[model samples]
Target: MKLTSKGRYAVMALVDLARFDNINPVSLRDISLRQGISLDYLEQIFSKLKKNEIVKSIRGTQGGYVLNKNPNDIKLTNIFNAVDEKVKTVQCRKESKKGCNGKATKCITHNLWDELETHINTFFENKSLKDLLNNNKETRV
Candidate 1:
């Protein structure tokens, strides 16, 4: 399964925010510049994130955004779900008799892809923003 820019950018933007938001709220423009993401696109992503309560906006002259929960509390799956990103591998539903290959039964590799998708999703579920932050720090050293 291919991850769209919305899913990738949302993670990048949040990582940037997590790095600096402790000092103050982070502006979408700042994250846009730092992450090389479009300001308008970030706005759209943030709107969904806000709606999902993944983040909260501060309104004022110094207004911006802050995470609704701690970094450790925010899993990659949570970010993905908040942005309506699906980690789907197969094109067809497993429950449905219709197959992705247009045949009566699923292709030989269908179970393989489905199992991989489950593992990938589980990895994301186990990983938190705090884990990413720590990994970043380790890589820098």
Candidate 2:
């Protein structure tokens, strides 16, 4: 699956929020600046995240966005899937007999597509935001 810029920025925004308390929201400006994303774009992406229940928004002087769940409870797959629904690698796929159009068996490398999708799902599902933090240290930042 190919993640669009929206998906990538959404993940980055979430990771930034993960560093702070859930009760405390982070301003869109701050997130945009830190992630090098445009504030307007982050605002749009955040609205979708809020709709998905992946984030909670607050309105006030301290208004901003925060995660709805513990970072550990939020799987990377959730973030990924929330922003990008095109989770399959296969393009123009189909099936015939088993309702399989030209998309599935029509391709000479059907198994490869299936295997790749499975691997991608497995990798993301097993990963969490905490894993990202625990594994990385001394980042360029």
Candidate 3:
């Protein structure tokens, strides 16, 4: 399954926050410039993050946003769900119990994709922002 820009950008933005968390309440504009993300887009993404309590906002001249939880406690799945990013591996209409074939019966290949999707979700559920940071450091080394 492909991760949408909202999901990817949110994760990147949060990582940027975690990276500079020592400063506390890093502004979206700063994250946007550093990560090459659009400030407007980051604002929209952060709105949802705030709603989910993944990030907290502070007001004032030095106000911005900060992580609500520690980086190690913030799972990748949390980021994905906060932005409503669906990890869809199939073309099936999820509202219906029937498979992508639009019939009452399940498609022949439905189980394969379904299992793969489960594994994909589990992978994200197990991964945290700290994991991403550690991986990045390894690659840089």
| Residue-by-residue lDDT tens digits, candidate 1, 1-141 | 478888899898889999998899999889999999999999999999899888999988888999899999999999999898998777788677787778987788988998999999999999999999999999975
Better model by TM-score, 2 or 3?
3
Better of 1 and 2 by TM-score: 1
Number of the top lDDT candidate: 1
lDDT, model 3, position 41: 95
Flag clash pairs in model 2. Answer: 93-103, 94-101, 94-103, 94-104, 95-100, 95-101, 96-100, 96-101
Better of 1 and 3 by TM-score: 3
Off by over 4 Å in 1: 95-104
List candidate 3 segments past 4 Å from native. 93-99
Q: Clash pairs of candidate 3?
A: none
For each candidate, what TM-score against the reference? Answer: 0.87, 0.82, 0.90
Worst 10 residues of 1 by lDDT: 92-101
Q: After superposition, how far is residue 56 of candidate 2 from its true place, in Å?
A: 0.5
